[model samples]
Target: MAVIRQLDSLAPDFDAQLELLLAWESVADHRVEETVAEILREVRAHGDVAVISYTNQFDRRQLQAAGDFMVSASELQAARERVAPEARRALEAAAERVRAYHDHQKQESWQYREADGTVLGQQITPMERVGIYVPGGKASYPSSVLMNAIPAKVAGVEEVVMVVPAPDNQISDLVLAAAAIAGVDRVFTIGGAQAVAALAYGTEAVPRVDKIVGPGNIFVASAKRAVFGQVAIDMIAGPSEILVICDGETDPDWIAMDLLSQAEHDEQAQSILVSPDQEFLDAVERALEKLLAELPRREIAAVSLKERGALVAVDSIESAIAISNRIAPEHLELSVANPEKYLPLIRNAGAIFLGRHTAEALGDYCAGPNHVLPTSGTARFSSPLGVYDFQKRSSIIYCSPEGAKTLGRVAGILARGEGLEAHARSAEYRVRNK
Candidate 1:
C-alpha cells in the first residue's frame, strides 16, 4: 500500500506540513550545468561538427553527416500511414480540436486613432521560426507534438522545426505522424543539450530558431536555462502535478484513479486531494490501494504517492479552495457537485477541470485545452503553453504632429524630473515652441 500522507486542517502543524509538501527546488545539478555549459560552448564554436559528434555519441547513432539527421517529408507521411486507422482518426480528431481551440487565441494587430489622428495600439506577429524538442524512445509523447506544434501553426509561425532523439536510429511513428498532422516544417533526429544548442545557435544543418519549446530530461532543461537570452523558451517546466478538490460527492474510485494518473507521470510527480469529507478521503485511499495494484505503472505511481502525494481533510469546501489557491497546482480538478459555483474562488491553477465527470486526463489529451502547464507552483503567475506564447506583440504609437507636440511636453517634464537630459531634449524637440 502507498503511504500517502494524510493531513487535517485542524492539526497544529498543518501549515508547516503544507509548506514542506509544496516546496520543490528547481536548481539544476552543478555537474549537469558544467557539462551543458561545455556542450553549448563547443556547439557555438564548432557549429555542426560539435552537434553531430555529440548526437552520434549520446544517441548511439552512426550518422556520417549532419544532413543525415533531418527526417524527410516522405518518412513523416509513411509514419502517418503506418498508424492504425482508429489511432489515426483519434490523432486527427484531437489535432482538429486543438487547432480549433488555439485559433481563438491568435492575436491580430489592432490600432485606434486619436482625435489628432495619432494611431496607438498593438501589433501582433508570430515568430519567424520555432524549435520543438519531442522526447523519443520510451518517453515518446505524440500529444506533446500536437500541443506544441499546432499552437505555433495557429499563431502563424513561418517555420516549426522539431527535434526528437532517435536512439540507435529508432524513432516513434506516432510522434512522426503527430508532427505530420500538426504541420511541422522540419524534423531532426537529435536530442539532449546538443539539439537545444543547434536550435539556439544555428548550425550548418539545423537552422536557428527564434524560440525553442518542449520538455526533455535534465540536460535539456539545463541547456534551455543556459541559452535563455540567446533564444526564447516556453518554460522550464517542473514535474507534473494534479490537485483534486472534491466535496465527497464524486466517486471515490474515480478520484483515486485521477490522482494516480498524475502520480504515474514520474516518481517526482505530485497528486493531492483536498476535501471536506474525511470519510470520502478514506474511501479514496482504499481505492488507491486496490486499483494501484492493477496499473502497469504501479511502481512509479506508488513511489510518487508515498513521497509527494497527500490527502488533506479540510473544514469546508471554501477552506479547500483556499488551500488549493495557496498550492497553485499545475492541474486542478473540482470533482464536486455544483463545481461552477466554486470557480470564482479559484485564483490560481494552470488549468481548472470542473464537475465530477471532467477528469484531468481529458485536459492532457482531447479536452481542447493545452496540457503543457506551469508546474512547481508557477501557476500563481504563469500560464499554460498557448498561441500567445508563440506570438509577439509590439506597441504601436504613430503620433500625429499635433498629438506629438501635446504629448511631448508631458514626456519632457517626466524625463527631466528623472534627470535624463537627453530624453528631455528629445521630447522637447517634438513640443511646440510656445
Candidate 2:
C-alpha cells in the first residue's frame, strides 16, 4: 500500500497529516457544471453558429463553416517551415526567452505633480484582445506556446487569439510552430467549451477577448468558470505542485528526479519532500523506487506517487520552511547548500527553484518565468503569468484648482462623514465656497 509516504515532521497528527496530504477536491462536476452551463448557453446564443456547432461536436471535426475555424497565415507559415531545425531552434529559443522575460514586466504611463498642482499616477493599458488556451488533444504544448503567447506579446496585446483542440482533424505542428514563434495574433481549430465559447462570447469566427490566458480541459475549466465576468480569466489551475526543500546534501538521485518532475504531472500531482535528514528521507525513498521503474510516465507517476506523494522528517531547516509556508507550493525546490540562505524564508511560492542546479524542469521550459503558475494554495493569493497579466491599470486623477481646493476641502469632510449626501454634494462642488 505504501510506495511513498514518509511524513512525521514530529508527527502526532502532524497538522492532521498535513491536512490529509493537501486535500484537493477541485470542484467542477455537476455533470461538469451542467455541461459547462449548456456550453455557455449554446455559445451565448448561437454565435458563429454555436462555434461551428461546438467545433463539429467536440473536435471530431467535419466542419463546414465558422470559416472552418481560422488557422491560416499559410497555416502559420507551414508550421514555421516544417519545424525540426532542432525544433525550430527550440521554438526560437523559447520565444526569445519568453520575450525577454516579459520585457521586464512592461508598464509605463506615469505622472506626478502635487504641491497643489495635483496629478497622481498610473495608466498601463495593453489588453485590446487576448485568448491563448492551447491544451489540444494528446498534449503537444510547444511549451504551452511559449507559456501562453509570450505574455500576450509582451503585454502590448492587440490580438493574440490562438485556441487548439483538433482531436480527429488533429492539430499541433509543435502547436503551430509555437504559434509562429510566439507572436500568435490568430489561429484556431477550436477547442472545448467551444474554444472557451469562442474566446468568451464573440464569434463570427471568434473575436471577443479582453483576457483569457491558457490551460484547460474539464470543458476548458468549466468554460473558464463560465466566461468570468465576460472575459478576464487565468486561474482555475490546480493539480501540479512540487515543494522539495532538502538540505540533506542533494542527489538522492537528484531528489528522485525532482520528485518525478511534479510526479509526471497527473493523477492529481503533488510530490513533496522536506528534510532534516532521516537518512535523507531514506535516500529519497530508494530513489523513488529506482526511478519509478524507468518512467515513460510510470503509470502516471505511479498514481501520483501512491496518491499525492510525500517524504518529510523535518525538525529543522526551520521545520522545513514552516512546512513550506503551510503548503503554498506550485513548485518550490530549494535543494539547499545555501539556496539564497533559504530565500528570504520563502513566504509562499508559485516558482522558487534555487540551487542544486535549479530545475523545476527549468521553470517548465527555458526558465523565462511565467509558466502560468499559482496553483492549489494559489501561492497564497495569486500571480505568475505576467507582462502583468496583459497590463490594464488606470488610476491617474488630475484636480488642480489649487488641487481642487485642497482636495475639495478634504473631500467635503470625508463625504459628510460617509453619510454621502451625493458624496457630500460632489465634494462640495469642488469647494470654492462650500
TM-score (C-alpha, index-matched) for candidate 2: 0.35
- Tens digit of per-residue lDDT, candidate 1, span 307-355: 8999999999999999999999999999888889999999999999999
Estimated TM-score for each candidate: 0.97, 0.35
lDDT of 1: 0.93
- Please report, in order, the local distance difference test score of every candidate based on alpha carbons: 0.93, 0.84
Please estimate how well model 2 matches the true structure, expressed as its whole-model Cα lDDT.
0.84
Query: Model 2 segments beyond 4 Å from truth?
Result: 1-61, 67-117, 121-129, 139-162, 169-204, 208-212, 215-243, 246-258, 266-278, 290-296, 299-330, 333-344, 347-371, 374-383, 386-391, 395-434
* Candidate 2 C-alpha error for residue 77, in Å: 36
* Residue pairs whose backbone atoms clash in candidate 1: none
* lDDT (10s digit) by residue, model 2, range 1-434: 56788888786888988888899888568899888888788888888787777678777778888777788878887988887789889778878887898898888989999887888999888888988888887778889878888888877888888888887888878889888888787888878887787788887778889888888767788779878998889889978889898888988998888898888888889899998989988988988888888989889998998888989898788779888888889888888887887788889899898888987998888878878899888898887888888888999998877777777778778988887888767766878563
Worst 10 residues of 2 by lDDT: 425-434
